[model samples]
Structure formats: C-alpha cells, structure tokens
Target: MSLRTSLTAFPRQALSRPNWRQTVKTSLVNYGDQRCGMAATAHPVTQDSTGSKGPTAMVFLNMGGPSTTQEVGDFLSRLFADGDLIPLGRLQSYLGPLISRRRTPKIEKQYADIGGGSPIRKWSEYQCAEMCKILDKISPESAPHKPYVAFRYANPLTEQMYTQLLDDGFGRGKGGRAVAFTQYPQYSCSTTGSSLNELWKWRNRLEGKRANGGKEGEGAIQWSVIDRWPTHESLVEAFARNIEEQLATYPEERRNDVVLLFSAHSLPMSVINRGDPYAAEVAATVHAVMQRLNFTNPYRLCWQSQVGPSAWLGAQTSDTVQNYVKKGHADLLLIPIAFTSDHIETLYELDKEVIHEANSPGVKRVESLNGNPIFIKGLADIAAAHMRSGQTCSRQMTLRCQGCTSERCLEQKKFFAGPELSSLVR
Candidate 1:
C-alpha cells in the first residue's frame, strides 16, 4: 500500500478498553473484511477433518537474539551466515562481509554486558505468546486459533521452528501446499525477504531429507508470508502519538531547542549504495511523526550498531553526537525508529554508549524514546491492526530495474566506502 494512506482517525485506546487484545483483534477482523477482503476470501484448509486439523494461517516471526551465548567467534559467524538479521537491501552490502566479521568482537563485548548475549529469543517468545492470545480473543470464530510460531535469525531455535510447525501438522494435508506467515512489522531485505529465503531453503532441504517433507500431506499446506505492515494507519497513529509524548518530556525552554535523533539498526554503506529502502522508510516514519506533531523543531536520522568489516550507515549515534557537539548543538533526543520494542541494542548502544557521548559532548541530556506509554500503545495498536487485517504486506527488495524484477545479489565494497570526511554522509 502507498505509505500515505490515511486510516480512519481513532482515539489511541490501547490499555483502557476491555481485553484490549480482543478489541484490537476484532477490529483487525472487521478491517480485514472491509479493506483487505476477508471472511469469504479467508482460507479453510481442510476439506475433510483429520482430528487435529486447524484453520490455515501460519505466521513466521523473524527476529534477532543472543546467539552469542556460545563462543563469540563461532556464534558471530553463524549469525552473519544466517543473513536474516540485517534489513534486506540494507547498508550491509556496502559494508561487506568483512565488516560483519570485524564488528563481531565489539558485538560480543556488548553482549557480555547484558549477561552473555541478548535475550531476544526469550523476549520474542514473549511477544509471540501475547500476540497469539490477542488473536484468539478477538477472532475466535475467524479460525481455530491457528498456532503462531517464532523463529530467530541470530540466536537459538533457528530453522528448526519452521520444521517443527510443519511437523505439528501445518502441512499435514496430502499435498505439499501450505501458507506461511512472517511477523516483522516492516518489509526490508534482512527482515522479511531474507527470512523468506531462509524458510524456502529449509523447505527445500526438508523436501530432500524427508520423504516429500513439506508437501501438504493430504493437500498442500498453503504458504502465505506476512512480510510487513509498513503503512498501516493504526501503526502510524500509534507511532505518531508515541513521539508526541517523547517531545513532551522536555521542559518548555528546552523543547524547541531539542532535536529528535531517530536511530535504527545500522548495516553497511554498500547496501544503501546499492538500493535498500530501510533508511528511507525510517525517514518517512520520522516525517510522518513530525507532520502529526506539527512541530518545527529540527530533527535528524542516524544509524547505530555498525558491526562487520564493510562500512555501515553513517553518523553512528556516537559520531552523530560528536558532530552535533562539534557544530555547537547540545540538546538531543533519541528515537529508536527501526525496532518496534526495546532490545539489547537499546540497552547497550543507545542507553550506555550514547549516554557516554552526551556526557562527553557536555550536552544538556541524552533522552531515549523507550518505555514511553504512547510508544508501547503504538506497538499494541500496530499488532492489533495487523491481527484484524489478516493479510500479508508487500515485501521489500533491491532491484536494479523495474524492467527486470529480479534482485541481483551483488558484492559490496569495504573500508566503509572507508574513511569518509563526514560520519553523517547520506
């Protein structure tokens, strides 16, 4: 959908309503029926019952985790190898494989701070559980509470989760036909597109390893991927309103002087050089909030967590702080644009390192947008809207031309496009 689609204005009623999850779920169901074409269009896989058959709506939640609990080097390599963690068509291609390798040690040290690695796997599971319950409550009649599963790109429970779901009868039909769901909010290469490639890979291997492994047993289990929800209105409203509160945190005099520093998970410069829309989407979200806020305060976007040998998105938060300091600007506000919820990157990089930069720069203060009520409500609203819509979003990719709708996986340059005059170079 076009990013600017305006949704019906609704009050940000996140926690106040009864069974907020259920309300959102019901809304998603109705909204899906109206906008996305649902109910009659929805699939009911089994023509005949097999005792344990379920309504078909298999979703795959692709996320990052602390796969670093193991020896740092091995885990780091494996994490990069999985290739699902970065935003597909992101800054990484420009940064190249070497950057990922070089950054592993630094990543390991950061993980060490949070007790060996991130609890991404654990927290992802938490998100999954909460979503499943919300879906069941809101759309009990829609489907038989089709199970929602979580998978990771960088940590424990990798491709195995997909296999387990298949085994659990997602494709128990006579044919090798089943649909899959993706649980990432935005569609970028590293998140949705890359995860699908991994899923397809697992399916190929299973097809070879097991006797007609992924083939829908009685019938093919339909493969439907829920790639992203980039332009959903509730999502936008949620985020827009959340940003409003972050702006409110500062005092009147400091408010106008403060700058909103939107930060997202950073990849290499090569990816953006090639053509990843991740940074664009981030900017769009920020602009959307600005429009919603109707504020004239200056704002900027920056990248963080530059891991690997190749150059990643510039103005690493630290560098951004330095640049602002050098330019003689002090007040800054950090808004994590990429992640829907808080993860390790927030705790370590933004919270710890950025704080250090704020101190070093002698700035007034360094504030983060984490734990803001509106932000949390925005997340809940996005999830609720998606559950109601019941349709997958358009996937993101890097294509050379509209003439050839193919994504060419080209190699990227190193040294960060290296040693640039400015850290915040676009």
Candidate 2:
C-alpha cells in the first residue's frame, strides 16, 4: 500500500487492538534505544550520481530545554535574551541577564522535581530518526535523509546543527537541500519564526557570500521549510487516540461528562495583539482533535506557563482548573495540545503545580505524543508531502504579521522562500 493509504487505514487498525496502550509502550521501548543509538553516530552522506535526490538533511527545530539541572541557568539566559520570544527591546542586554540569573535557582528546582532535566532531547532524537527512516522508504527521491536536532535555547543549537551538516558533507561548496522542519505544530513568530531567524543568521555567518553570492538554489544547502502542520489528519488522530485512552480510565457514565481542558503554552497578550497565528492554530488543533473524538466530551482551550505577569492570554489553565473544581465539576482531563512532547511545562507546571494544587483525582493529564508511532508516521507523511510539492515554505509562512516591525522577520522569510520570494511575499 502507498503511504497515504496506510495512514488512512491506521486508525482502524489501531482501534482493533484490545491493549493498545501496552502495545504502543512495548514498541516504544524496542524502538527508542535503536533510533537514539543511530542519532548519536555520524554517518557520511554520498549523493547518487544516477539522478537521485538522496542525502537530504532533515533538521528538526524547537525551543529545547536543559538536559540537566546544571544547564538550567544557560537555558533561561538564552531564553530571556531572545528578542523574538520575549522582546525586552533596549533593556534586553541589561534586564535579560539580570532576570535569567534571578530565576535560575527557582527553575533549577523545578527541573529537579521533574527528574534531573527535560526528556525533550531524548524524544526529539528518537522521533526525527524514526521519521527519516520512514521517509527513506516512502519518499525515495529524498532518500538517505539525515536527522539533525537544532534547539534554540539548549545544546545541539542551530549553529551547532548547521556546522554538523557541513562536517557531514552537506553544504560546504557541494550543493544539497536541507529542510528546516519546525517541531511546533502551530505557526508562531515567537517559536518557529525565532528558530528560522537564528538559522538564517548562522547560515550567513558560517556559509558567507561565497557560493553564488549567498543566493539560494546555487551552491549552498538549498533550504526549504516544513513550517507548520497544526491540523494534519495524523496529528489529529494521535491526539484523539490519546484522549480516548484517558477517557477509558474513568467510569463509563462519567466519561461523557468529563471536561476536556486543552492547554497550551501561554503567549503574552502583546504578542497575540501583534497578530501572531499561534493561538488560532492551537485552537484549530483542538477543534480537529475534538471532531475526531466525535465531540463526546465538553472541552475548552486554556493557556499555561505565563511568566513575568505582563498580561498573558487566558483563561489560564491553572485558574480554569481551580474554578471548575470549586464549582463541583471535578472531572477534567488536561491535554497539553500545543506540545508534542513532555517537558517542564507538562511535567512540572501542569502536573506538579496545577494538578497538585487542585488536590483532586479527576484533574489528570493526557500523555504527551512523545515517540507515538502514529505521530511519527504523521510527521513523515507531512515531510513527504512537502518534498513532493517542491515548495520552499508554506504559503502561510510568507506573510508577516500585520504588527511585525522586525527586519529580521522580513529577511528570514525572504531567505527561506528564495527565488519565489517575490511571488510569496505579501
């Protein structure tokens, strides 16, 4: 069967399994070590001279978390310093360091509570490797896809990933293609946009104006982007399946009545007012998941993890949970809709802070879509479709926010969109 056909039939096959959870867990254990092992080793890339589009670099992008407690200080420092995410402006140079230093100790304890660090790195490696393996088989034109993780805040950063691409025989004068695949399902200037800008910045610094005068489609790693996939069918299915699993845990009669609280990382109201599409895209994911679930349970979208208290987008997840429980509506399922994998937000903020304070058994969380085979397959499908389309970035990615003022945003979009920049730019 074709990849599309298999994906269409996946839900039916999955639903037939009596112990789906156990089955998935068993597969995850068997798959994790192998994929993670592959990610650690460097492999040489050789292009096929016989008309093959092989040896493509598939770079996964995200705002990565610290892997250990000791790294939390650096993580927060980089995060605060990012003008795209926080935008402290002129005070950025001064206040960024001061704020990060003050918050590091508290953040360290939070990371400690979750474990020693975030499991983001582990899951990201596994997912990307596994997806590339599938991409090789299904999209043989883009075969031999090498998986590389580029984190914005932590190790294996954008610069490091780009350098590795060069070292691995990608773009040092020999022309090749590399896709900046954002792991964020939704499009947001603060998240995916920031990462792309950083990538563009490093590309200029490292590659310089040597190959074709830094023009795309010449001698550089001809870049493309899988910018966003908020409402992809496979994504919606994976989320719906996880929710169904959680719903099964409750008593049969109460299951239908349980409130589905779809939570995402909160953005500042200022950012929202700037016409960032993250909130709308997040809501689209929630709606798609609910439609997949047949709308059996009541649901509301809430925001979480707001910092510095500068008027964030709400109804806040924590407050919503508290108020709902206070009104005697105790059965609530918190789904971290925005994040594909678990990190401090899900492990510490939602689990430790919100649910713990709620002090009720009904306030539980759906598992993050980490290492989910369905989700991985979804990612592969998305990439395959993009490769087949031969598009630079999504058309949605070409348009800047109405209130966007940064020259970085303008150039970054132009850089990725390349020759088609004229037609794509609004």
Each model's C-alpha lDDT? 0.52, 0.87
Q: Could you give candidate 2's per-residue lDDT for residues 219-272 as a string of tens digits?
A: 568889999999998889889888998999999989999999999998988899
Flag regions of model 2 displaced more than 4 Å. Answer: 1-4, 8-42, 49-51, 210-218
Tell me each candidate's TM-score.
0.68, 0.93
TM-score of model 2 relative to the true fold? 0.93
lDDT of 2 at 124: 89
Clashing pairs counted in every model: 51, 0
Give the CA lDDT, 0 to 100, for residue 102 in model 2: 99
Residue 228 of model 2 has an lDDT of 95
* TM-score, cand. 1 vs. native: 0.68
Model 1: weakest 10-residue lDDT segment is: 409-418
